[model samples]
Target: MNERPSRHVIRPSGCPGLLRVVQALDGGICRIKLDGGSIQADQAEAVALVAERFAGGVIEATNRANLQVRGIGPERDALIESLLAAGLGPRNPAGDDVRNLMLSPSAGIDRRMLIDTRPLAEQILTTLQTHERFHELSAKFAVQLDGAEALAMLEHHHDLWLSALVRDGEPWLAFGFAGVPLDEPAGRVPLAQGHALVVAVLELFLDLARPDQNRMRELLAEFSADEFVTLLARRVPLQPCPDWRRVASTDGLHIGIHPQHDDGVFVGAVVPLGRLDAAMLRGAARLAREKGDGSLRFTPWQSLLLPNVRADNAAGVLARLQALGLLVSGDQPLAQLIACTGSSGCAKAMADTKADAHQLAERLHRRGQALNIHLSGCPRSCAAAHIAPATLLAVAPGRYDLYFRDATLPGFGALQAHNLTIEALDHWLDAHPRSPLDA
Candidate 1:
């Protein structure tokens, strides 16, 4: 047998990686960060097999478009070895934690994409993993490369964000920091300089940020964005883009069959509460192999997309996915709900968020309403990277405080009701059917 590459020592962090399994209430968790969430069919099957053999068969599709195996046993090393053999490990061991780049699951295939982000994403990802200096970045420090795809996750804020644009009939990338692409860009760079811009921004951040300031927002709080951008200009050419703003992405495009830029179509399905079993994964992999391209792309919506499918085969693929116990329709109440690993898995949780979300879904479904709601076990908001239209924060077992998303307010928006049970919350929603909170 070939010897495995020696694991490099990484900075201390609470987050899990393929080489670092963090203990949770359920067991250990090992996160497998995919390049733009793309996973080959056979590689996915290997993941399923290892999850069943070494963990509790619980595989979760994270909000960051990554997968994690929960309830791992003492055979953690074996599980890691299996995944590594399947080519899921980082290019370099130390690169694992810093591989926090997000791309639209429909990056290359989206009909509305301005440019194919895969090539640029590849360059950035390689630099992130192989560049030794970048290893000092916080595990949560992330970057987003937007191709202006209709199905992009534009709400999730990142340390740095780049969105493709066209200026004077030439391709350019509008860039910003400490926000999403929807925000007005601080500057623009030529398309060919996208990779250089990313490298310069990261290097500048590392140089200026204090040891205590690990995130871009933290550094910006001390050093103004204008000041940072001024220094960045010295590293790379920057063009003012004061009037440039990214277009809003269409919601629910991540859930049904969507047409690609080419003749092929992509079928998407929601993984209930972001949790999947070994069987569900294996089945999806098989379908990907048979009906679509031999790969699956997970999404920031905690869903998976089977891309490159023939238009005629899209419906059948969707149906097969549904048979695997995945939610293929937006009307499914669970498809609109997201929950964290509550008391059932996380020690910090005050309640079993997953079970409560299920109960809430049933109530909403019976009422013929499918609203986008997030159920968080605690203030950490592990389930959602972006604020949902409505948030239910747990205060005690079966009780939560409801908040409505108000652009004017911060941190889960304005809190509306405090400590209401799942049943009472259902009643509250029923009472306010016409309110914006209905979303």
Candidate 2:
């Protein structure tokens, strides 16, 4: 007989974990963090099954490339057991919350990748989970390892980032603290020392940070990044990384068929509003098993990639995904819009952002315009890790404050309009055709 999954004492946090199901307006939510966003078809099916059997059949593709099962009932332990049986749980119960590492969905497959980050990522992940001290780290404390992939999510800020770079015909990792990979690196280390450097940084952080200082950005607020780097050098050898800036990644690589460095192609499709019904997930898993490599890689854009699909079979896979109601094209207005679980699932939500998003998409499609828009139920901006080009902040039911992302302005950027209905907002967006909202 298979042993029952050991239930661990749930920790106190707003975030959910595989073992820690946080209660939401919809019910309990269990977050399953994938290693490098990759899940086998069998495992994906397991998730689908549990979502249908124990939850309300709602699966979310999170911005970090993880999956969450929402609307879970009292059978939380049974649901956790099912996921743990599928090998989706953390190495240890205590380690679940600390495994907040992000990787490029196209890690080893991207044609533009300079290094295969999988090996290093595995090493870092193993350390993060097995190192008991790391459990002290905050659940939201995240790290990003970029392999110079064209399909990478470079805009999302991380507590620590190591981006692959070539120096003197050798691969090196450009390191930065409390920022995205696009920022100027604080220093560089040999690719081989990448894991050691990460260990050193985390240890240094834990030693220097107070109990209240959980994130690197918070610690940096009190201590200078340069000073911290100066201290880190004594622990890990580092080299100057002056004039090194990560090249801008190509946009929209998360959707549609994209060529891999290898012979096979990757078929990408975005989940409508980051949601997948049980049927949609099972269909995708079946497609992965039949046409692709039998594995699915979720993307930070709330999309999933059927990697290693034959170039010839890519079209068929994409067509099947579209038939399943997934958005396969970036040009579709619905594909460009993202909304958080609003009043339906979140107590903090003032408006039904998802319903509003659907209305906005229809209007934008009618105008033949597709702009990246984020609809937040509140100011927390839980759905998006980075700022979208345009944001609609809900103030009241069916009414929102509009803002366009500005280089200079803070939180949700510069306000453009206040408390406009979806219809009025659509008119404003149509009138400002060439505004940053369009970008």
Q: For each predicted model, how many residue pairs clash, with residues at least 3 apart or on different chains?
A: 0, 0
lDDT for 222 (candidate 1): 80
Error of 1 at 345 (Å): 0.4
What candidate 1 gets wrong by more than 4 Å, as runs, is 1-8
Candidate 2 lDDT tens digits, 1-439: 1122355755678788898888888988899999999999999999999999999999999999999999999888899988989999988888899888899999999999999999999999999999988988999999999999999999899999999999889999998988999998999999999999999999999999999999999999989998999999999999999989899899999999989998999999999999999999999999999998899999999999999999999999999999999999999999999999999999999999999999999998898888899999999999999999889999999999998888798899999999999999877866877887665
Candidate 2 backbone overlaps, count: 0
**RMSD (CA, Å), each prediction:** 2.4, 2.5
Which runs in model 2 stand beyond 4 Å of their true positions? Answer: 1-6
Model 2 TM-score is 0.98
Instruction: Summarize candidate 1's per-residue lDDT along 239-275 as a digit string, tens digits.
Output: 9997887889998988889899998999999999999
